[model samples]
Target: MEKKELEYIHSFAEYVDRFIRLLIDYSPKLVSALIILFVGLYVIRFINRLVRKIMVKRELDPTLSKFLADSLLWALRVLLFVTFISKLGIETSSFVAILGAAGLAIGLSLQGSLSNFAGGMLIILFKPFRVGDTIEAQGVVGTVLEIQIFVTKLITGNNQTIFVPNGILSNGVIINYSMQGNRRADLVFSLSYDTNIKTAKDIVMQVMLNHPKVLKNPAPTVTVRDLTDSAIHLSIKPWAKNVDFGDMSSDILENCKEAFDAAGIVTQPFVREASKG
Candidate 1:
């Protein structure tokens, strides 16, 4: 054999030896890392199930409970990842620093979402409103159906669904009709000037008082509000529980119409004047 060929063979053997030694040295670390990963995953699942059970037992608010659970899950996952890396004999400080930097970048990029998350947390903490409450805010009046981390879902009177961002909802003015448990309805009725004011008042007042939903403590009131050229406007104010407000107002109006007609009290609906010929 030539001297060059022998040297080439010797070099190939040296490379193979180094490769085998490397495989032997690193195999245990790799296996340990894999084992740690699988075990960590199982523990995470177990912890998640336990937390869910605790939340159910405590009857915690669904949105807040979900947020807490997810936060815990991600934290555990990050810790597990760090442990897996360290088990593989890799330095963790630089990896941790990299993770921190990446997290900061992601936080900055998702500023709006983070703000919404914070708003949701505040809502859960302070409880300005809750699920199933009827509220009016940002020009939308509806019942709260669901409150999530970033957005809230509302179902309006006409059955239209609305999605309002938590950031806006928390920061803006919220009028929770259900919070106080009662609401006042302001209604106006028109009558011809020729109609007897006392009789008209009695008929409308009777209708409101007879209604089962109207609260007796506040008592319904009927007062002459304005004197127009064509008619007299009577302001009718009734207080009812929030749950009964809609039905009570509708019932009062309908019953008042029937009563007014029966008593010969004429309610004049104003009409727009026609253009002169």
Candidate 2:
């Protein structure tokens, strides 16, 4: 009986040894698959980082930077995931098809959002305006406070915050006031026709030259823009830094009035002609 028991144990051990050999023979394929997955994931992360660095170095806007980074990272992650799955002997074509169908559905549902995003890309690449720049678009005039993927925040002269869709802002005409670094301060002054036009012009020019904010290089211009029945029109064009626009405008007008008063030049007011007297 002892001899029979020994033989039984030897047979069981031989079966176990055969199973171990079979597993060892197949381990290389499993190890290769795991290695491929790990390497693919590492490459994806590295490529994503490289793309972000490149975009940031291009001096792109902050909002655009984030958008591009996320897009590139997502694309790389999807590619790595597909490669890893394929290494495990799984077909990726069906997975890709499903993802594509889902993406199409989501995109259709969020058409407005996608439009704004596309508009934002155009604005960023073209750079029509930037934050803190005063712009007039679609009849809305304000200083840009923030630029987002879908909307732009603007603070109007009256201190009200307005959110404008990027799609509309990008499609419409944009007039940027702060792009030139200086603004032309325009002032129109009218005097009685009896007043000497040349004298009035000299007084206006002198006032502009003496003002602190007026630029000296361009020189202020005082010209007769038009002649009205009741008044001689003088158009005063002064070049001033953007920061000094408000002060320079107010000072020029006030000084023109004072100088005209000192010179005894009487301002004239418009009068409508009586109809069919």
Candidate 3:
């Protein structure tokens, strides 16, 4: 029994010695790896900040800038992790292969999401519209609230929130009404055939030109657009700042009605001619 106990103690000492030697052999490499990881992390953070500053200076879209910074940081950190593991004498080929396989599986499962991400990238690179801009697309007209990777948020005139997929939005036609600082208000008014066309045109033009919100540079125009059996159609076009478009148009329409009524100019409805047998 004493001999067995001595043998067990000797075996335990040998195990401890082997562990000490392994630790000594690996200690320097582990310390160096840790230092490299810390430095790499710091460098990555610095690069991310630098990139963000540059993006801000270049006036890149905020949403896109953040996405790019995060993606770059994650990629660099992943590379750093791989380097740290390799420094510890760990094989990385299999690790990278596993990551690749996992990425492939995720990609396959999120094909639609990937498409939206691509679409978002395209939108950021080539901006068709910006936040706060009024746009018409997907049979909806609304102001852009937020631009994101998967979807864009819009607030309609009726105050409804809509989430539009970036994939469809990027592919479809986007009518940005606020791209131009000024917008033209096209209004059509009909007067009775008995009312002089020239008089009606002059009245509408006077109202448009005298409006405070209408731009005077381009000059508002009121021209005879069509001559119907029961009425004379006049097209009134006035230019105004985009922000004041609604108010300007509404005021002009109301003013025209009041002015026509005061001048005894009657608005008439279109009358179709009877088909001859």
By lDDT, the better pick of 2 and 3 is 3
After the best TM-score superposition of candidate 2, give how far the Cα of residue 163 lies from its true spot, in angstroms: 2.1
For model 3, what is the alpha-carbon lDDT of residue 246?
92
Q: How many steric overlaps are in each model, in order?
A: 0, 0, 0
Highest lDDT against the true fold, candidate? 3
lDDT of 3 by residue, 51-134 (tens): 999999999889999999999999999999999999999999999999999999999999999989988888878999999999
Please, what are the lDDT tens digits per residue for candidate 1 over residues 129-244?
A: 99999998889999999988889899999999999998989999998999988888888788888889998998888888888999998878989877989898888888899989
Report per-prediction Cα RMSD to one decimal: 5.2, 7.7, 4.9
Best candidate, TM-score: 3
Worst 10 residues of 1 by lDDT: 268-277
- Candidate 3, run of 10 with poorest lDDT: 268-277
Those runs of model 3 whose alpha carbons end farther than 4 Å from true positions after fitting are 1-17, 228-230, 268-277
lDDT of 2 by residue, 1-277 (tens): 6999999999999999999997798677668778987887788778778877887888778878888888877887777778777776689999999999999999999999888888888887788998889988988999999988889899998999999898888998898989999888766887898899899999999999999899997888989977877777788888898778888988888898889889999986531211211
lDDT scores of the candidates, listed in order? 0.88, 0.84, 0.89
lDDT of the structure predicted as candidate 3: 0.89
lDDT of 3 at 84: 99
Query: In model 1, which regions exceed 4 Å deviation?
Result: 1-13, 227-230, 270-277
lDDT-based ranking, best first? Answer: 3, 1, 2
RMSD of 2: 7.7
Model 1 lDDT vs. the true structure? 0.88
